[model samples]
Target: MRLEQITYFLSVAEHGNITAAAKSLYISQPALSKQITLLEQEVGLPLFERQARGVVLTQAGVQFQKDLQNILKELEHAKKNAVLAGRAQKPLLNIGCFDGSYADDFLPSVYDYLKEAASGQKLVIHKCNFLEGHEYLEKGKIDLWLTLAPSWQDRPGFLKKKIAWRKGALIYSEKLQVGKKENPTWEDFKDETCVLVKKSQNPGMFQHTLDTMELIRLDEGTIEVVENIGTQISYVKLGRGYCFLSENIIHGSKGLRCISLPGERGIEVVAVWSEKNAAVTNLMENYPI
Candidate 1:
């Protein structure tokens, strides 16, 4: 019937003795008995059977006690969750990855460090469009963005950090003989077309390929393919063209050589975050390379 009455009844049911329940509740025996009697009257049923030494629960009392215990546990749990929700503390870190596979090798190490650094912080990486990078961070859709370098460079109100410059190598068949690996040059690739993956298929990978094209300042034309990586490799093996691939990408693949270029050229990778997001900014600064 009432909160106090419910508590008093539970106490007596637990001890099965009015004297013991009253002593535990810091109340007189008569007071505890009167509260139990009122609770039984409100419920229109007897909850306990009087015995010489202690009280025994009635059939209704047994069911009522089980239900009351369950209800009280649920109420306590709800109150705890309500307090947490009111605080508005979201310990989440969402990352917009230009290409998850591009950074897959290093992402785990980064995740390990963040987990060790802030055990409560949750990290999530979602593949995102390279072109819509600014909007992702601006709209708070992502806490941080990992994209090709210079995309966020020169932009005000944003902080940029170079995460990687993947080692670049030329992937081609032995038939071309463009240039020796010992003395690689743009002139070797001159007049030769490069095969690239299409953005429609993999936007992030397409952007990385474009970055490679831009880095070498190749004036040559490009052939775009869709659906799979084999298409690009096939072009090279068939002597159709050469495609620039990151060293890791070309490694362990058959029918092609990963030629190391002479000059310092690579797919520049960077992490972008808004300066206004102090929490994210701090995370980016301390993030392991």
Candidate 2:
């Protein structure tokens, strides 16, 4: 199938509705549907089972989606490698990190280690969200991933080490007064609702939230769940509920009060990398993480 057909198919699968997918992609619904039809004809299989409300992936569609995702990641790596080779740049090590300074303390030392020891090696940082970074690490697009733990992203052939630890952030509406304490406990949040991002969007963060809440003895009387960060933050701004985020990224915003939520189970900044990298020995040897 053509690349555009593949892209359209993925969007339709993600939205689970042709019309919604078309709107999201800024294309006409008829055009998108025609592409899907052509793709299905070429594949000789129905990818999605049509439904009254929307559509659902058939078993074959699920497998195809997973395979296509990996193929795309590998394709990206191939493109980057060709360009880097053409430029005759230094040997590259791609580092994927969550978009924040949480892991900044450990990076300077890593930089020093590379500068003093492996001077020929080049380091490139890819700032990404949890899912993007996780996907990059899995696909070998990145040599390393720095993120918050406990990482629920358990997979074989990958190694993880705790690089550092920090407090988590409590996000709430500025109008609400939980107390004057520097760090607010779950007791202060007992009467209010807690907002959570959908587990499917960020499984690691979802599991971490549950784990941290359990550790801090949260007694949430109400709960609201949203699809993503933007919607989650909207709920908080509307005073619907409070949520927790990574410490380093959560400086209080215009309408939100983001503060330390330190407790027994605090944030663990972690470094995850594939076990098969050439520089694995040097990385593991020179640094604790």
Candidate 3:
């Protein structure tokens, strides 16, 4: 079977709908359906039970999907190795990460280490939402995922290696138009507007901090959906409101103060990948916290 066909099948299996898979693949629904039909005929079994809402994998389809995943992963590994051997500039590893200073802090060192180890390899960073990063990893769309804890739920065949731990820090500009301190506790900011980075960053860790301290009545529009670290910092700097960030962000900022969240269980950063990637084992050992 063709690799493109296999890719289309897997995408449909992952998304459980032809339309979603078509959108993801940047192809039309009719073409995707025709390919799926061709694949099913070649396999000599009805792999999916078609339904009005979406297709469900038949028993055979479920089994085939798993086997197909294994085969595709092996092929991808082979391709990566061949690409590494032939590249002129540098062997590359595409890494996905959450946007912010977290990536800025860790990626530089990681890149340095990989370059030193490979003698000439280059590491490329693709900033993505935490959930989307994991999804891409599962789909073989990325080589690595570096993200905060709680962005993931257990999935078969995936592995995560914890790298660094940092408490969420409440941060605000010293010259902000409101708020009492450089760093306010969850309680202090609970009543005022609070800007946040993204839902993928996992706000639950801070939820307990707010609840335990009896901090309530978070104002409407308090939650600003920031796209990146720079945006969050800009919001705080512009006196828009406050935000919670990794301690790394406030580490050396001239006027930024970082207050530890009450109690521990602070966020942990982890490097995640599929176990099938041969590079993962070696890279895991070399990952810099």
Candidate 4:
């Protein structure tokens, strides 16, 4: 019945295994197991059916989990309102950013809008990988997620709103022979090495590149992975390899030429938030895409 017990139960349910959930919750496995036991005793029903690999929720447990989620969300909302009313402090909006420049193009407008509509609200940004950002959103650690649409899969309760679209193109050094083509198809770069950002940083882009190469039957290209955007840009600039970049991001680069990929569709930038986050939902509805 305690809040900590409910949290432990939810963590175990999420991870499916006591050890993994304990590790995630930063507590001892025995302690987590004890909490679950206490919770089950109080509920007068066995919540999870234990198994060799992990555990599965009983039918009652499934219902309880859903109810707990709603209860926690409401409690969080109440807490925020209470803090705002009691202290007159700025409400915090924690945003998770998958890409370094995720907020560069659209956030200024969002800031302007918030200044007028939500005067006492404060915005905070957390830069992390796509998977980490998604985790934070799920755990109620962040209020909003701003990143490429493909970075995270659509979950049942999360609301995804597309904010912008940018054309895709190959960015290469002007000195490279591959850059000589006015428009290059995948075949043109089949033999060239491709510089790629780390998969963890942007798995969607990495998979898209693989899929594109597979579709064109161009499997001969070398793939080089770098840690970040700066490294990818440096590789392309020095002619070490070429990389794919959005058209909006390619503007004003001095030594690089961006060639449109054949039949390339643009990528979408989206703002995603939980269905329970009323503040973010409101902001998304009013903000221009």
| Per-model C-alpha RMSD | 20.5, 5.4, 9.4, 9.8
lDDT of 3 by residue, 1-289 (tens): 8989999999999999999999999999999999999999999999899999899999999999999987876686558656765774776677788776657767776667766766656666667666557667888877888877666666788888887777766667666544545445445655555776565455543453344234323434356666655777887767777766666776677666556655673667788888888776687876666
What lDDT does model 1 reach?
Answer: 0.71
Please write out the lDDT profile of model 1 over residues 1-289, one tens digit for every residue.
7778878888989999999999999999998898898889988999999999999899999999988886786476446445654664756676777553446656676667766766666665656555545566777767778776634544788888877777778777655666335555666676677887666655666666676667667745556564445567677777778887667765554556666654776667777888898876776678767
Clashes of each: 0, 0, 0, 0
Best model per TM-score: 2
3 against 4, candidate with superior TM-score: 4
- Which tens-of-lDDT digit does each residue in 184-274 have in candidate 4? 6667777788887788877887887676556556657799999877778878888887777676555666777876656756678788899
Model 4 per-residue lDDT at 176:
74
Candidate 2 per-residue lDDT, tens place, 104-132, comes to 65677766665657667676667776777
Candidate 3 deviant stretches above 4 angstroms: 1-90, 177-187, 198-221, 252-254, 286-289
Off by over 4 Å in 4: 1-88, 180-187, 215-217
Query: Sorted by TM-score, highest first, which candidate order results?
Result: 2, 4, 3, 1
Q: Please give the TM-score that candidate 1 achieves against the real structure.
A: 0.52
In model 3, the number of clashes is 0
Range of the 10 consecutive residues with the lowest summed lDDT in candidate 1: 219-228
Off by over 4 Å in 1: 1-90, 173-192, 197-218, 225-240
Error of 4 at 147 (Å): 0.9
Local distance difference test values of all predictions, in order: 0.71, 0.74, 0.72, 0.78
Cα displacement (angstroms), candidate 3, residue 222, comes to 4.0
